[model samples]
Target: MSWKVTFRIYYEDTDAGGVVYYANYLRFLERARTEALRALGFEQARMLQENRIAFAVRSLSVDYLKPARLDDLVEVSSAVRELGRAQVVFQQQIVRAGEMLLDAQVRVASIDPVRGKAVAMPKEIREKFKTLMGTPA
Candidate 1:
């Protein structure tokens, strides 16, 4: 299943031509992922402080298909594509109305906050991700 969040494009998200800046698409996707995690009962800040775990992007690839203009209402969608011991790969997309504007694959790794090294996801977190992966694409 895909987790989706809607956001309105503001002036800050755009360039002088009123089109969203290419880099801002990454930020939009990030927000959706954050919300998805929250929906699963994980809050990043609390996880870091209480669980000593943090997440970081390991890799990302994006395809820009169309430009989103200022004032457009966009939906960012995210779903787990692959789950691993130390990393989770997510497929994400940004769309306006029904048109896709960007597609991305983002790999995120769990880390030991103190050691700053990659680590296995907490058992509960891993289980939650597994459930998400089982959802229909």
Candidate 2:
């Protein structure tokens, strides 16, 4: 099952023409991922506070399948597509009602908060992610 979150497309999220800006979709996808983590009981800020580890976007490749306009209620569906010792890849999509507006695959790497270098994800967090991945919780 996919984790879903919805948000309104505000005017600020759009360009002068009122279509959601290309870059803002990335932001939307990020928010969905953050909320997904929160749903899994791992808050990024608190994780950094306790483990000194944070996740950073390593790379993103998005496909703009359609345009979403201001006032549209868009839902972003997210799911963990892959997991690694130091990184995770998520497959997410932005949809307006029944239509798909965008889909993206994002790679995020766990890093040491102070040094900003790659680090293995904590086992507890990994286990939590596994639950989201359809393994036994």
Candidate 3:
């Protein structure tokens, strides 16, 4: 199951050719992931404040299959693919209507903001993420 969110491509998301810039796809994926967390009652800001930890992109792989033009309505779908003590792998896709435009796998790591090093994810947060992973979009 996956979490889905829709957004329109604004001019700012496009390149000079009027197609979405390759990098903007990453931004869209991030937005979707954040919203997914929010839907599960997790807020990044509060997580950082209360847990003293933050999530950072450790690595990502993306493939673009189609181009999205400005003003096009796109949907971003995200799901947790793997979970570890200190990291999570997110599978995400960008689509127009029912057509997939891009797909990516992003690995995010939990880090102690003060020490700038990896840390275990809080137990409650981990449980919530696991629940979301099995839920339908």
Candidate 4:
């Protein structure tokens, strides 16, 4: 299933032209993914502090289709496209009033925060991601 979160574009999020800065789209996508994980019963801070595990973006490709203007309300949607032993591929998009604004595919890898090395996700965490992957978006 897809997880969605909405954000309002503020002046701080925009450039001099009043359009959302391109880099802010990454922040929107990150927040959506974090919220999605929270909805699935995992908290990133707890995961890092207690389990010593943190997630990092391995790679991403984004397409900026349309610009979002200041004061606009945008929705960010995220879904698990693929799940692996220590990583997941997320298909995400940003939309405004039903119009697609951006499309992205992000690969995230679980890692040991201290060592900064890739690590296998705990069994429970992987299982939860599997469930998400099986659900319809």
Candidate 5:
């Protein structure tokens, strides 16, 4: 299943031309993922404190199809496309109303903060991600 979150475009999210700055989309996507995990009962802060595990973007690719303007309400949707022992690939999109504004794929890796190395996610976390991978969006 896909997880979704909505955000309102603000003046700070846009350029002088009133269109969302390209880089800001990354921030929006990050928030969507963070909220999705939070909704699943996996708080990032707690995960770090308890498991010493943090997720970092391993790779990302985005296709900008349309621009979102200031004052627009946009929705970001994310679904698990692939799940690995230590990483997940997410299929994501940003939409305005029913129209798509951007398409992206983001790969996130579980890492050991102190060692600064990729590590397998805890079993409970992997199982939780499996639920997202199996459901239909």
Candidate 6:
């Protein structure tokens, strides 16, 4: 299922021209993804402490479709697109006032925090991710 997280644009999230900085959209997407995982029963601190693993952004492709000015209320919709042994791909879109402002595909790799090498996602976590992606195996 898709997760929707709403956020209001702040001065810090914008540029001098009062438009959201292009790079900040990535950060917004990241936060929404984290919240989505939390909704799926994964917390970053707990995952790191118990699984010895953390997620790292492997790649991200973003399309800027429109602009959101300061004080605009935007919602970020995120969902899993693919869940693999070592990576989870997510689709995210940022919308404001019924208009899509940004669209993105983000790939995050599961890795051992200490060794910094890739690893399989935990079975329970993988199951939830598959369910979220709606391609359960």
Per-model CA lDDT versus the true structure: 0.90, 0.87, 0.90, 0.91, 0.92, 0.89
lDDT by residue (1-137, candidate 1, tens digit) is 77889999999999999999999999998999899899999999999998889999999999999999999999988889899999999999888899989989999999997898999888999888765673323
C-alpha RMSD values across all candidates: 1.4, 2.8, 1.6, 1.5, 1.4, 2.7
Q: Identify the leading candidate in terms of TM-score.
A: 5
Q: Candidate 1, clashing residue pairs? A: none
TM-score of each: 0.95, 0.94, 0.95, 0.95, 0.96, 0.95
lDDT of 5 at 69: 100
Can you tell me which runs of candidate 4 are displaced by over 4 Å? 134-137
What TM-score quantifies how close candidate 1 is to the native fold? 0.95
TM-score of 3: 0.95
The top-ranked prediction according to lDDT is: 5
Candidate 6 lDDT, 1-137, residue by residue in tens: 78889999999999999999999999999999899889988999999999998999999999999999999999998888888899999989998878888989999999998998999989989888875673111
What lDDT, from 0 to 1, does candidate 6 have? 0.89
lDDT of 5 by residue, 1-137 (tens): 88989999999999999999999999999999999899888999999999999999999999999999999999998889999999999999999999999999999999999999999999998888776663223
Better of 1 and 2 by TM-score: 1
10 residues in a row with least lDDT, candidate 3 = 128-137
Q: Tens-digit lDDT track for model 4 on 71-122?
A: 9999998888999899999999898999999999999999998999999999
Candidates 1 and 5, the one with greater TM-score: 5
Cα-lDDT of candidate 3: 0.90
Output the lDDT of residue 11, model 4. 97
Task: Tell me the tens digit of each residue's lDDT in model 3 across 1-137.
Answer: 78999999999999998999999899999999999889889899999998998999999999999999999999998888899999988889898988889988899999998999999999988987786574323
RMSD of 5: 1.4
Residue 77 accuracy (lDDT) in model 5: 89
